[model samples]
Target: MNSWIKLSVCFGLCFSIAGCSSLSGMFGKDADYRKNEAELAKKLEMPPNFVLRRSGDPLVSMNVSTAQMLEEIDTIPSFRAEGIRIESNLVERWLVIEDLSVKDVWRGIEQFLASQGFKVEERRLDIGLLTTEYLARKEIAPVEQELTMISRLLNSWRDEMVDGIYDRYTVRVEEQASEVRVYFSHHMMTARATDTTTAWRLRPYQPMMESLALYRSMLYFGAQQDHALQQINTQRVYQEVKEADELVGLRLAATLNESWDYLLTMQYRANWQVERQQPEQHLLWVKIPQAATADQGFFSRLFGSIRTPGLVGIKLTPVSGSTAITELTLVVEEGNLNPKQRQQILTDLGLLTE
Candidate 1:
């Protein structure tokens, strides 16, 4: 048989469209699919609405400016923009799947989008780290040669048969890698339901019963939202960023971790870098915007995220050794970003250009 033909034949035997959407219906012995899912879920300690999976990490190196990317972005067609259609009135919004895993889906989406007149600017991946830990343990039963001893001893108090107990396995996938390196690690949590029910009376009894219960638990807890992720056709990507310039000020402000010293006395010499090579056009770049007013710790938005709370403006930062992929910043208005706000930014850059 041809190599590809042989591979296809093998998959034909193994893959089947079965109870993928129903957690409660997926249980049967030799049904290793649901069993594996149960074990994986339990091993991760994933709660209802939590998740466990793997994919690429964001590549962080540059601060993208909206003005520079906007002209190019305007050409990109909107996609999968929330398949919502109300009364034939085309909804005016982008369909988004805001998950970190969107990176894995964008590879083909960008192409599909280009075929439809859309522009996609792929962000470089920033390597990060992953960590793991163990959450539980169980006892092992030894086999016995004596028939009477084997049936009456350890098997007498067997929870699976009498109390309908199941040992669950959960797994957690986490990432902690830095900008240059990426790490993947997992932790597990396993335990049995404290109560029992009279269920599953059949040949494939113990394993099948436990499997169903575990699967049910996984669904009861594993739902997550990917709001910042965008998808088109079958491909997914980070939503186009509308602002990174205004982000610098927001970030710088967060670093202070406090309301800008409300009444503190501080001063900043204003410097606007203006450049207009063609005299016909004008370019005025202010490194900082006004301080962020919305409390983000309460909102939890990504840096440079357009889904970000709101934008007044933006700034740029070079990837220097001192530059962190993430920064907390606050840039006040000429005399308003809090008295101490301007001082902090100027001090950090050592740009006291009198």
Candidate 2:
């Protein structure tokens, strides 16, 4: 009876120490410390026979089970991947929402734009393209009911009352392996004072305005919480590469049809305005704009100093792969692009992957 009591006390003490160590291991400052504690807990299964007064065979089995439970806790996702994340680069930004389908994002975008007072002028779900009608400057924001004379005068100087200023937004959606990439393009229009009618011409793109629009969209997506967002273990199967000759292209794990649809939808995004697409020849003639200037907060001119609208060809070819797996290669037509210019163009196209 005494021996049993001593064993009970020993096991009780062991459990108390193990529980505290396991809790501390979860939030220790150093990773090594947690690892060592886990190892020590596993070793506790076989408490010394001298200390236990008898062989601790039962205690050994219990320790193994406790060690496994602790290890399972470590497999949980990191805090960042647990929820939606708003990420951005120089040219574009995207949200990482786990387990969200392309269709879900498409619907969310339409609802978001409408909520922001943008009338959906056109929508094509089959191709996943959405364009908003030009929203006048006045309708873009709520009107201030009361304005002092000094404030009104300041508004005049701030171009707040400029006539015929309006903005248009376009959203592009592309499906990645497990997530979606959303791209937003902003177009502006100004009414010519000389015209008798209301005619609006395309205005230059503003980086700040574009970023603001995307940020708002991300907020809306997070608030909806319609789909479950969690971390997914995915591989980098889609990649873009540049050849020794300075030609740029993509090596995707998707088939020709999948790649075609993705590229076609992406044309509406950013400044890659599509002129024509020829699926037969697997070629597309696109009008890519020159880089923005210092006034726009980006470098000037992409391919050359003389910036003019011209057609650039994009072609896709099937590499080698099985029916279930497809390997497609993307390449530029390389019409008049010099070696240096080709390298620059490749770098710009690489941003498409992001």
Candidate 3:
């Protein structure tokens, strides 16, 4: 038989009436088809020891639980994996995939970049470094929309007239044991023209863009662990424990590393700026700003300088046990607070004591 005839026969045999949605989930753009794909994507949750198997072609497989089936979905990217986590550093947000090898994450990143329309400028798998070509994208301004349709239409058009910006990024992947940490750095560029030619010049660094790209990449990683993480009971209210004569600041129902990450995440969520952090010594110095007064509007609260930011001292100590738990201690260096009031402050800031 001819090659075309044999291929056609194979496809016809693979896509039977019972398995037609599998094919349409990939190529079909209709509303119902896309909805089906989104539904399938939502049902996918990878266990920590998940395995992928492919015999011949995955599209022809009848198993609904196959990893290949989930990979075929073309929905918007997300980071909903079981062991994936997003962390904020001094200037950037990063991804930490637990129990995954560096090689596995490297491939996932390459696939993610290709799916996001990024052209790979360079790649060194040995060094776990990837660089992408500069991409030009329009800067969109946030538009406030009125209730009326005409008002919303005008605002939408106004958003289109916003300025353009270019960004280039470098990603570094570091492997620790069975886990990998991915960090991103963004470099901005501006258009420059002389009498002869137009070129792009590197602009000053924009930390905001670095954060934005990191978040967008998190979506591309599609490893959301929110539900599973919540079910793990690894988070807990802070507690004051007496270790000998010293009163420990807090205690957590997590390991030492988990406690550190949780503390950093909590600080980031609370908008507390880190002044100094020493992981080796388990100490962090952060500027905790006072709450905005009722008179301070949104713009003022966002743009104004911190008038009475307090310098807080945080320390962590791991308790010895099979189950991971850590002791956290908090102290105010420049404020006057009694023990009762200090506990109250931590409680008011969502650091509950049990």
Number of the top-ranking candidate, with lDDT as the measure: 3
Maximum-TM-score candidate: 3
lDDT values, one for every candidate: 0.28, 0.58, 0.62
lDDT of 3: 0.62
Q: In model 3, what lDDT does residue 105 have?
A: 77
Candidate 2 — number of clashing residue pairs?
A: 1
Model 3 spans with C-alpha error above 4 angstroms: 1-81, 88-93, 139-164, 192-200, 225-354
Ranking by lDDT: 3, 2, 1
Q: Clashing pairs in model 3?
A: 78-222, 79-223, 79-224, 80-222, 80-223, 80-224, 81-223, 81-224, 249-329, 250-328
Ranking under TM-score, best-scoring first? Answer: 3, 2, 1
Q: What TM-score does prediction 3 earn?
A: 0.40
Two-way TM-score contest, 2 vs 3, winner: 3
lDDT of 1 by residue, 117-214 (tens): 33433333342111212222234444455768657676767544222222222212222231111111112222324367433311111222222322
Superposed by TM-score, candidate 1 places the C-alpha of residue 183 at a distance from the truth, in angstroms, of: 20
- Higher-ranked by TM-score: 1 or 3: 3
Q: Which RMSD does model 2 reach against the true structure? A: 21.0
Residue 211 local lDDT, model 1:
25
The estimated TM-scores of all candidates read: 0.14, 0.36, 0.40
